[model samples]
Target: MTQCHEDRVTGALSVTGNAGGLFHLRDGAVIAVESAGSPGVETLLLSSGGISAEDWDAALVESVGTGSLQAALVARGSIGLAEVEAVAVAALQDGAFAVAAGDVQECVVVSDSADVPLLPVTGGVAPALLLAETAGRLDAIASLPVPLSPYRDRVVPGRATKSMSGERREIVAHATGRRSARDIAFATGRSLHSVTVEISRMLGEELLEIAPPATAFSFSHWGLPSLRPRAPGQSSGKEMDWTTTPWPPNCGRSERTSPE
Candidate 1:
């Protein structure tokens, strides 16, 4: 992501799945972002009392055929400059993380002419900077030890959070296995990143357990066997010793010598 954006590369990166993201970049900077897991900035603004739904609609009306909705909001004194910038940056970060949550193998990048209409950017961010911040956020979550490390893996409270209090306890109490971190954030008025990190920590502390994410359709899921870890003392899965390993039931070893 940093490389694509840093070289001022023009294109879009699409994570090829339901929980994926589409990021449009221009000349090494992120211009527009959309994510499946995270809601738009408007949701956060309304939830945080930063803006009202009616006012947002009015701003949309004001910007009809004009310019950026964010710009219109600022111009109309609907929100301050700093707040608008903050919201935009946060939303972008959220989208980036949401895309990242997908398995890295599933993500694919393609370059092309920048002709597609992108969501009007509230602000642009350098890809390197955006990626760095997102990595740090994920790191905060990953520092905690847990059985499941995948982002889309849901979690449920496994043990009582009786020993915890405040936000931590509140978060664990609400882990019903049906909600993703983003959903919990909306329900609890917490930031998505914070909730993700917190859930990771609680899981490490044995206050939570892993659950499968909502099932989705994919040939990989149904037909493809997932990668498994190498057996004990094995150097690598690719270097399997088929000769010494158990046979596929009654298969005989080859008696023929190597062909001269």
Candidate 2:
């Protein structure tokens, strides 16, 4: 990444390993990043109610294969460019954290012809700034009494409790011995970094525990309900009912340490 920044390259860096990511750089500055271990910008926007399902579908249609869904959304006034940019930034930071938290075996540079990000940070962000923040998040997680990998360890509810509320409560509600922190993030429409860190702290509180190897889980999306996030330009053919999203009523567009 440092080398790419120095060279002022505008292209995509495809990283492959335990967890992988695609970093989009424009003029040497990172505009966006995508990682399977973390929710994408599309998920963030839809899950946060920053845009509606119909709005996303319309944008996808308008952009077609142009890879300019961001422009389409803005053109229609369905959402502001700044709002989408905020979500893109959140996705970028969390994507970086997800890739770093795992093992990275290789990163190959692809030409600028690679499809543009559905949404990108306007003016972009310095790679150094992103790396610094990701490092800080990792350091905070390392400081936990029991640092846990969001993707590797399946967790189950611990010490029965009824008082948990907000995100933590939702997390516990989904810790059914069949899911990892990553799964919970997908189910809750939250950033993987936040979910992983919260789960690590909860382990210390005895509110969660590692699932035994012998634990039998259905594995069908773990038989747990999902937030059913729809990727941009990819539709389910059926409109999603998103009125019951689990986001806290107070959740807003502010940039969180690990925005979801």
Best by TM-score: 2
For candidate 1, write residues 1-260 as lDDT tens digits: 77786567777777676567777777767876677667667776777687778888888888767756776777767678788777766777887877676554465666884544223454468887888888886776666565334445666777554567678777776667766677677677656676777777777777877754442211222232223443455444434445455443222232344332
Candidate 2 residue spans exceeding 4 A from truth: 65-67, 75-78, 216-260
- Against the reference, the lDDT scores of all candidates come to 0.66, 0.82
For model 2, the run of ten residues with the poorest summed lDDT: 250-259
Q: Looking at model 2, how many pairs of residues clash?
A: 0
- Backbone clashes in model 1, listed as residue pairs: 5-28, 8-27, 8-28
lDDT of 1: 0.66
Question: Can you write out model 2's per-residue Cα lDDT over 34-69, one digit (the tens) per residue?
Answer: 898899988888889878889889889989866688
Q: Which one wins on lDDT?
A: 2
Once fitted onto the true fold, the runs of candidate 1 whose alpha carbons sit more than 4 angstroms away are 6-11, 76-78, 104-123, 147-151, 161-174, 186-190, 204-207, 211-260
Q: What TM-score would each prediction reach against the true structure? A: 0.64, 0.78
